[model samples]
Target chain A: MKKFEHEVIFCIVNAGFSDAVMDAAREFGARGGTVIRARGTANMEAEKLFGITVQPEKELVMILVKSAIKEDILHALYRAVGLNTPGQGIAFSMPVDQVVGLSEAPIEPKAEEQAE
Target chain B: MSEAITKKEKTPIRARAARAPRGSKRIEQVTAPHKLKLLFTIVNRQKAELYADLLQAYDVNMQMFLSAQGTASTEMLQYLGLGDDEKVVIASIIREDLAADALHMLEEKFRTIKNGKGIAYTVPMSGTIGVAVYQFLCNHRGDRV
Candidate 1:
């Protein structure tokens, strides 16, 4: 199997804001994402330690994209709902070793030229 | 809870003492190297709990299970044996050494089980912002904060 350099973007925001997250990501060229419903277990102790109030319910949006555009997508996400924003979301990326099921490869320059 | 209590009662005092050090040693082994990977499992919603339980048994607890919808068309979904568009996405922070075992367990389940017809993958976490946060994410229960 060939290794396709990819990154998984995890954006955790206040509940019910997954659409906003996806929207921001799409603007920055992300094809699609998976939204997961999660609950934040950060208690008062965590709040005091981090000096931030963590929302109890969180929506985690996971986006798999080409490694090349990972930074662009993350920056777009941060601007939309980052820690300074009302959603108070935290976004991070990790290196994915492999990927499958994506309908199109985001990194193929040939595909883009053919489309044009 | 009852099962745990009963098991505790059944264990001999010396055996329990012997097990305690091994458990602590395992924690030390996981934390000493300080490498982390994120395990992502996409499975049918019904099998999500079972997947989580399997990971927990491997000491890969502290998972985030998210409900998601697959974008595959109906025909594609049926071909993949997915009953519906609904899916469960589980992400757990695990030590690097245990990631292979975790992925293997998930893969076995995916192949043998009817509802486990999804995918499992891992991502390397380059770094965590703070030591306290890293401990909170990776440490097992009662491993000392």
Candidate 2:
């Protein structure tokens, strides 16, 4: 099996700011991303600790990108929607072992491909 | 109740082990420092429920999803839809072994189902908050921990 050196990056920001996260990520080499509706549970004390207003409504943008360009994308995301900014977004990445269903040549050939 | 105790006493060895005290309920799932993975499956909105239901058969206990506007290239989007390409992203935390099987099932479905092409991948989780949380997320339900 062909192993994919990919990173799944998640960016959580206040609602309506996912476009910024996706735009910043696209600045690097990210082809596309998925946005999930979420809500943050930051209270007044949390706001005091973080020194940023916490919007309860949150949007999580998940982008799958090659490991080679992970850093660039994250850095861009930070500048674009970091906590200091109104977006108050945080970004992190996780390692991905397998990728499927992309038009790119399937890692394990299907029976038809194998026959061919 | 006496009946409850009777049932407990009559429980099989494995079931008894499941209810065993001192945090030994998940003998198999928690045997090693096994970290679960988050399986992300993005598919067309129409088939989200079908895929989510299929995932449940694979011992996936916890799963959630929300509509996502895919950022596919314009040409690809046009091919997939007239203009709107609504997608659903399903996030499920599963044990590594089950995660692999779920990915394989998804691959097969994408190949066979019409208009069901999508992407699925796994991201290893670093830590879980509690043993019970871990058990529930990994589908080790009803076991005393």
Compare the candidates by lDDT and give the number of the best one: 2
* DockQ by candidate, in order: 0.23, 0.51
Model 2 chain A lowest lDDT segment of ten: A102-111
Residue pairs clashing, model 2: none
Residue-level error in angstroms, candidate 1, position A75? 1.1
Task: Write down the TM-score for model 2.
Answer: 0.69
For residues A1-116, could you state the per-residue lDDT of candidate 1 as single tens digits?
64648888889999987877877887767775677777888679868998977778988888887888889988988899888887889999877874434445353344567899
Best by TM-score: 2
True contact recovery of candidate 1: 0.36
Cα error, residue A1 of model 1, in Å, equals 20
lDDT of 2 by residue, A46-84 (tens): 789989665699988889888899999999999999988
Give the B-chain TM-score of model 2.
0.70
Q: What tier of docking accuracy does candidate 1 attain?
A: acceptable
Q: State each model's CA lDDT, in order.
A: 0.76, 0.83
